[model samples]
Target: MNERDVPGWKNCDTMSGTTAGTTAVGTSGTQALDTREPGAGFGEMTRRWRDLTGESVPLPAFSAGTRAGLRGRFQATRLSDTLVVDFAADSAFRTAGTPVAGEDVVRLWIVRRGQWALGNSRTDNETTVSAGGFMLRHVGRLTHFATPPRTVAQVFVLPRTLMRERTVTGPAGTAELRLLVAHARMVRRTLSGLGPAGVEAARGTLLELARAVAGRRFDDQEPLLASPLAQAAKDLAAARLSDPDLSAAGLARELRVSLRTLQRAFSAQGESVTGHLREQRLEAARAALLTAAPGWSIADVAAHWQFADASHFSRAFRARYALTPTEYLRQQRELRAR
Candidate 1:
């Protein structure tokens, strides 16, 4: 399919052909397809996705009409000889195919956003995964999937030989799955900066976590070793610091960890969840103060960063940086002038 047939992607480049082979060798690292670029379209995205991951999407479900801003990001990271992590989001598509010979891999598709309808052509049975749910299948056989628009998902591709069972699926409520997702995120986020040894270590940690999720093995301490839940919390908090309701309990709930577990994770790193969150907010506010528009006020910056009020913001800012917001702003301006 070409760009003309796909709305919202009219500016993207067009190309043709289907059928991709997942012939990654000698540490292929990562392959990516981002349709958000200028002059980029699903035609090229599909071809690239097919070529990299050996999955084919000949027809995306846009016939009935789709949202105009149809953009997407896909990445397949080969973490080890036995493990590959595939992530895709903000796209509507369908994938149906039997593997080429020797394509012996098991795939676990975890849905983070919209629903996924997965079917087995042979059995004619289907499984639907809602947000926070997961479906696992052995890709050595026929499997099909339909993803809804604006879907966010991740697929953990493992060699079939690694799994003791043929299928591994789980509900949205599983703590194990949540922890696995956390670990996967940690590994993916840190992979680029890691040395060869660090990457291998992360790969092994994630693979073990995946095995535990598949019910192959388990150790109570395995999850903790696999993920820096505190770091993940910090990353998430930094992004959502503007929300006044964001707190340790909310963060723990979102991360699928107990309040105690969240506290322990932070304590292990010599910090408290609320304290770290506050520090991050203050830092963000400080940066904003430096570049804020002339009309922006101290109270505006304080409110934007979720401080209770300008007075509370000033007290906290003074305690942390030894200067009130007003003083810090003036000091920065004076420094710039000098």
Candidate 2:
């Protein structure tokens, strides 16, 4: 397809469509591609977009530093098999003329770099999202959103059947909204650091974020970590790692338990209760040293994780990993560069 063949092709809009309905919107300012026509700009752009997003829409306009000064509705013609995404950046776009609601698509809004507000009159619920926040609305649900000028958002329209296969769960009978500041930051960092190798990572991150917002706990929320007894023991041990007087006896007394009972729990994991505490503190110290960025001395990282002293931390780190912390970090960065 050639650029001229694109129905509403314009220099200010950049889109790539695959098959029929699958379209991807690019942030770069360029012309839409017409897959049905013979051309380079549009065809190449659309192909790349199709590769990025599994589902697509028709062509979409990419914002070119334009600002929406007042209340207005933005519309685009797009369709997809399982998902449709209407996206805009640097513009405040809203729905118009009471969109014909249907339960065919589950809608999600991701604030890429700005703030947004969305609500459903039918459900009497509203949500506001800043950068990294997401809002979900069920298919065929009547919804409204208002954003300040220069807001940027990507609207994802996914089918209910697609989400069902994933067994997503959340607040019953209400849309799930999540603030993912940390997750988003991590994803962006991974993307920046790894380049093309980060594509799979990005997909996994998106799915995990979706599941989390849907009220699903991934491995990060292990049941063991959430157990009251386990948490209390962990806290107590963490607080007294530096004191030689700190032992299972002290921990048991602090937790209102006998030493034997505490031992039983630790035994279940094949770990000595006091030994596990020491191991954790040492591991934390090692991690701090390995991850300390340039300009941070190895001694500083060891101190931050509360090592007994630099010499103690160095011996422990070498024994555990067969290398000093500084050497380990140097190797890690070299490996990443490759």
Candidate 3:
């Protein structure tokens, strides 16, 4: 309860009424107690979490089964520059609390064992996470989660500054409410790979996973460029661009729109759906070539961008950039050297 009582975990002088816990066993930093109960004593926790992560949201009840009797523990620790938190409960409970807005908390959770469901009021996104899957919480709006029976999860609470410094974009703001279901077996394997000495490695791997999920959502907004049907069709096409067999019929089937409707959607943009796909593919290919290493072969770069053949890739590259892939790479190197 008090700072002097808990050894290794001290009190942050700058943060009043908060306890700091540090471990010499691993990376060194501070751990602070912000809130214990789901609704009670959460002000400090909300303030500190928001300060570090820039996410604001209302803390919902731990569960709905108990009618708000069970209280969740809120503990935060700073490992080097990264922050970690743990929220646990052995019983089922729920609550209808006010929303916490404008705060972002990028959370990496390992549901050690048990089932949990997290719902976001703002995004209307509900995620049911099982024992093996990992959950990343992006805190910005009203969010809620509950577990059945004995549930334990280790949450890595990351600061916005640390994420930005690492060039890692996680589900922050409204984006955090989205649920990412990673491969359960792969997640278990990754966790197994993290022994006592592999904490840093584990942290990096988890961060990559979190960033990928968040980045995909961020990139997915391109489909909402126009409106109702047109944007939906465009989004579907973008999501399936890697599938070489993706066709206008397949896209129409996925979007549940008639071929005529799909055609009209693209016509509004003054281009056909097939034309858009070609343009996107060409743009992607150009980007891949531009970023390829100086010594990377033209064929390798072409393959990376999913070009059908080297000659076709060369023709498209020349048509678009007025230079072949080889010529472009050579010019880039010359510019860099100069």
- The candidate that wins on lDDT is 1
- Model 2's alpha-carbon lDDT is 0.48
The residue ranges of model 1 lying beyond 4 angstroms of the native Cα positions read 1-72, 82-92, 122-125, 148-150, 166-174, 215-220, 223-226, 235-261, 267-270, 287-312, 319-322, 331-338
Rank order (by TM-score, best first): 1, 3, 2
The global C-alpha lDDT for each of the candidates, from Candidate 1 onward, is 0.63, 0.48, 0.50
lDDT value, residue 51 of candidate 1: 46
Once fitted onto the true fold, the runs of candidate 3 whose alpha carbons sit more than 4 angstroms away are: 1-41, 44-144, 147-228, 290-308
Better of 1 and 2 by lDDT: 1
Write model 3 residue lDDT over 14-61, tens digit each, in one string.
222122252211222223442334343445544545543223223454
Lowest lDDT 10-mer window, candidate 2? Answer: 65-74
Clashes of 3: 18
Residue 305 of model 3, lDDT score: 58
Q: Score residue 197 of candidate 3 by CA lDDT.
A: 39
Each prediction's RMSD over C-alphas, in Å, is 7.4, 12.8, 17.3
